[model samples]
Target chain A: MRRLGAALWFAVHTAGQNFRRNLGVSLAGVFTMGLILFLVGGALLFTHSVDSVLQAQQAKASRIKIYLSDSASLASIMDFQLRLKNDPRVISVTFENKDQAAREAAQNPDIQAALNALGSNPLPASLNLNVRQLTDLGQFDSMARNTPIVDKTTATDYNPDVIGKLRTVISVISLVGGIIALILLVISLVIIMNTIRTAVYARRTEIEIMKLVGATDWFVRWPFILEGVIGGLLAAVFSGGIVFLGYKLFVQAAQRSLLSVPFDASYSAALLFLLVLGGVAVGAFGSYLGVRRFLSV
Target chain B: MSVALAERPIMSPAPALRPVISFHGVTKVYPNGTTALRDVNLAVHQGDFCFLVGASGAGKSTLVRLLIREETASTGRIFIDGHEITRMPHRKLPKLRRKFGIVFQDYKLLNTRTVAQNVAFALQVTRPGQRHLREKVEEVLWIVGLEDKLDKYPDELSGGEQQRVAIARALVHRPRIFLADEPTGNLDPDTSWGIVQLLLQINHRGTTVLMATHNREVVDLVRRRVIAIEDGRVIRDEAQGSYLREGEATI
Candidate 1:
């Protein structure tokens, strides 16, 4: 028990002393790790916000309007609407009669002027659909084209060009974001390892003396590991605070701009927790590897 | 082999006393294929003081390293206090090292720490929370005649004073065996003699001492048991021998 207490004290005391004595190196390590963590957190939050924005945009864009022929029966159109609503891919099906369609078109000045010039209501009754996924739009478009109640000339307004472009944008953004995050994490680990290695190298004589005097490998290693953990924790706290603050400011800026990005409190909290956990783990593992080569002496 | 033995005066220890350190046909070949020690056999009993005299690369350091398990013998066995250390696991090295006090020509003192802290460091690392640590450090400093310089750092002291601080650190743990590898290599003649006298006092207190050195004057004046190494082989072993063989000049 006494030996254990003494060993703990020695580890703590030495860690603190070494940290203070090598303040330049220690701060360099912390600052580098802090910067990398900030980048990682910022990139992750950016990707998440972008994804949420794209999802909202996709919901708005994922719609198809199926126009009905003048000779089609009202009962046949109603049956088609019901069938479309029952399909799992469709979120909603709303019928727009000729009068309703005319009223909606009148809201646009160019279409309203054209309607005013016409002698009668020429707009056809149509079923507007909200779909669950972008790929289902093509299926709905083809299904509407084959229906007898649908207009042969204007089957459905499902623009494949717009949907294809949006799909490509979302995929590319996610892939780039994932790649950036992975690269940053790997770089942070390498930098932390090298920094800790430099610290270990500076005090190699102390380690040699300790080993020569019969100090156990663990006894020698504990101080360095503790120092690393302390450094990692400090970096994480500072960087996490900065990231959250930046996220808040970013959310505010985005809200003031054209985008309506919300502040995801739960996601931010989870991210902060992960940053802290990652910092500690990296620090400890880096220190362990740094001190390993010297123990053989 | 017979001619080599006949050329030098060889005196073995008394067989009745079990040796504190014994090497049975020990040989050390480093990774680069350099044989540092070749088929050497020797023993040192408890409370014995032996001088290891050799050239720079004559395997003196290798022998010292082998004794501390710093380097394992390529082929052979080493027994420390009757425990075979050749196959001892790495985990048990600390316990094995606790049995010996070792010093180097460089002193190996932490320049950042004061004399008291430097001595106390050994106890703190090995004994941990040992009682009366301050008193033990002070006593050991007094033993090396540096009780007054307790608060001084290594840089503040001269080479001899720094060496004394190193000695105090080694002595603080009260190890059973004291190994000094060229402990006086950097000191002046008078200071070297003083350090050797300190080792003598330590040995007088019944701790075994093995000193590896090229200092011929100290070995001759003290006239203690001497073992000389040449070409990675033990050339001579004497009970109370000088640095050179009888009627021979160079070593």
Candidate 2:
């Protein structure tokens, strides 16, 4: 335990010393990591907001109306309404009687003129269904058509072509964003590895001397690994701040423009945490690999 | 067909007198197909000061490297203090290496660190406690006559001073054996003499000192046991020997 403590102290001290001594190189590494992380964070925020907007638009167009036949009884209509309400896909079901339908049509100027010309109530009672999912619309429509009392079923303002195009766009955006994020991650890893390699190369003699003095491989390697982790941590804090402020500003702008963006506090917190954790993991792993060749002596 | 040095008791009747280092038919061949050492057999007893004299590429450095476990032998076994180190595990190599302190021609001192820190580094790795670490560093620096220059970096010191710091680092660990690979190769005759005198003093204190060098004048002047190597073979092993073969012309 004592030896471990001493090793930890040495690693921490040396890591700090290395960072301070090579301030310019350290800053360059941090900046590179920050830039990569910022791009990745931006992509995440973009996809999340796009998904939220798609969901809001889908909700607006998910409503379907089932017209009741003239021979349909009130009790049967109520029973059908209860059955639809019990279905998980149905968000809400409202029953509109002939009187209510006629009243609503009279409120509309064009419908009122048509009703006045006809001189009779031509509007039929209908059951309005707001489905939770856009994909459930077809099943709900078929079920309503098969019902004995349902005259015909019509979905309100739902366009299959538009939804399909939007889905394709979302998938394409997610795939491209994910690929770009992965590339940035790989590039950042290589850069961190090279930075660590250079640091190890510069201190090659010190490493040799340490080996000659009977220092274990861990004794020599831990400092470089710690240095990498420190560099990554600095980058994380820097990039996290930038991403937080940028995302906040973006969400505010989206709000002002009447755009529905999904900006949850918990999600933002998780993203920040992942960025910091990823930075540390990449830095440590890179340093470990970089110093492996030098430790063969 | 070689006899083990551990079995031979001709050098001393005292039971405490043991071989500090032994090589029995040891051979080293690099992966690039260069044979550095060929069936070499040697032994150096505890408290013995031995000089390895040879030309460049005579396998002197290879032997030093093998002893330090930097390079493993292609065949045969080596023992240090009755322990076979030829097949020692990689994890155990560090513990074995702590038994010997090694110096190089380039001094290998960290230029970024002060003389005191350089010396203290050895102890800090092997033994880590601030109070004893400071005392040992001061003592070793004092022995190398660099106590006053403790805070000076390698660049701030002369070549001789730098070598002295290296020696101080090597000695700070209080190793049982001191291995010097051309300790004075980069120094002037006067500075070389000073470093040699320090090694002699270290040997006088009962540390088995094995130095690989091409300094003929120092070897001839010191008149110590010289093991001369030629083409990866020991051509001569004589106490109070000269640098070259008998009656050989000085190049």
Candidate 3:
């Protein structure tokens, strides 16, 4: 246990010394990692916002309307509304009487002018329904159409074509964003590996001396590995801060433009944590690969 | 002053003599189809000072490399301290290496580290105690006469000082055998003499010294046991031997 502690201490000490000694190269590596992580974070935020926007628009279109028969009794229509309100799948159901429908149309100038030209009220009373799930719409439509009080069921205002296109757009955006993030991750790994390789090359003589002095392979490798991990962690903290501040500023700007952005602070914090953890893991892995080829002696 | 090969009988030490190193029919053939050593048989007893004298490409370095287990023998077995290291496992190689102190022609010292740290590095790797490391480093540096320049880096030191630091690093572990591969190869005559004298003093302290050198004057002056190699073959092995074959006259 004491031996392990000493080894760890030496590794940490040498890692710090190596970092300080090669400040310029280390900074370059960290900067590259930070930039890549920033791009990934931005992409994540963009995809998340777009996803929420599409969901909100889809929610608005998902509302289904059922037309009531002209001869249906008011008591039956009120009973139907009360039954739907108790249904688990139904979010809310509102009954619009013929007079109320005509009044709402009269509020619209174009509809009011058209109505003034038409002599009698042609619009029917209807029940507008909001469902918990989009899939529940078809079942609710069948249920409403079979009812004696409902004369006809109008197809949902939700356009399948527009929904399909929006879904495609979302998928394409996510796929493209994911690909870009993956490419950036690979780039960061290569940069970190090269940086560590250069550091190892610079200290090739030291490695030779260490081996000659009977230092175990781990003794020589741990310092470089630790240095790499430290570089990655530093980059994570830097990029995390940048992403946090950048996202906050973006949210503020979006609000100023009267655009509602679904920014979740806890989610963003989780993402930040993941980024840091990823940085540390990749840094250690890169360092391991970088020093592996050199430790044969 | 002179003795014939037949007249100068080979001193056959008692079988009870504990050998620090022994090579039985050792052969080394690199992957490039170059045979570095062939069917070599030799042994060095404890506290013996032996010089390996040969021209370039005569397998002197290869011998040292094999002894240190840097390169494995292509054939035959080698024993260090009665442990057969010819096929020693990779995991145990480091522990085996700690038993001998190896120096190189280049005086391999970490330029970024101070002189004291350079020496302390050897002990730090094998023995893991900070307090013990400092004391051992100080003791070894004092032995090499570099106690005052402990804080100085390699670049700030002269060739002799740097070589002394390398020696100190090698000696810090207090190995039973000291192996110097052309230790004076990079130094001037005066510097080389000083380094050779230091190795002699170290050998005098009862540590087995195995040095590979091309310096004929130093070899002749010391008149120690010399093993000469040519074309991967041990052509001569003599006690109180001179550097050159024809100059094998006792001092």
Instruction: Calculate DockQ per candidate and list them.
Output: 0.72, 0.62, 0.50
Over A85-157, each residue of candidate 3 has an lDDT whose tens digit, in order, gives: 9999888999888889899889999999998899888778988898886667778777876898777544223
Model 2 residue runs over 4 Å out of place are A98-121, A153-157, B1-15
TM-score of predicted chain A against the true chain A, for each candidate: 0.92, 0.90, 0.88
lDDT tens readout by residue for model 2, B73-168 = 999888888778888998898899999988999999888889899898888877765457788888999999998998998999999999999999
**lDDT of each residue in B6-81, candidate 1, tens digit only:** 3442343454476999988899999999999999999899999999998899999999999999999999888888
In model 3, where do residues sit more than 4 Å from their true spots? Answer: A75-89, A115-120, A135-148, A153-157, B1-16, B247-251
Segments in model 1 whose C-alpha atoms lie over 4 Å from true places: A70-78, B1-16
Ranking by TM-score: 2, 1, 3
Listed per prediction, chain B TM-scores read 0.93, 0.93, 0.91
Output the worst ten-in-a-row residue range by lDDT, candidate 2 chain B: B6-15
TM-score of chain B of 2: 0.93
Q: How much lDDT does candidate 2 score?
A: 0.87
Q: Residue by residue across A37-86, what tens digits does model 2's lDDT show?
A: 88888788777778678778777778887888878999999999999899
Compared with the true structure, what per-residue lDDT tens digits does model 1 show for residues A205-287?
99998898899999999999999999999999999999999999998999899697879999999999989998898899999
Show the colliding residue pairs in model 2.
Answer: none
The TM-scores, one per candidate, come to 0.92, 0.94, 0.91
Q: Write the per-residue lDDT of candidate 3 for residues B1-251, one digit (tens) a residue.
A: 58875444334445558588998889999999999999999999988999999999999999999998889999988888877888898778888889899888888888878999888888877776556678788888888888899899999999988999999988987899999999999889999999999999999898999999998889989999999999999999999998987745534
Worst 10 residues of 3 chain A by lDDT: A152-161
Question: What's the distance in Å from true for residue B83, model 1?
Answer: 1.8
Which one wins on lDDT?
A: 1
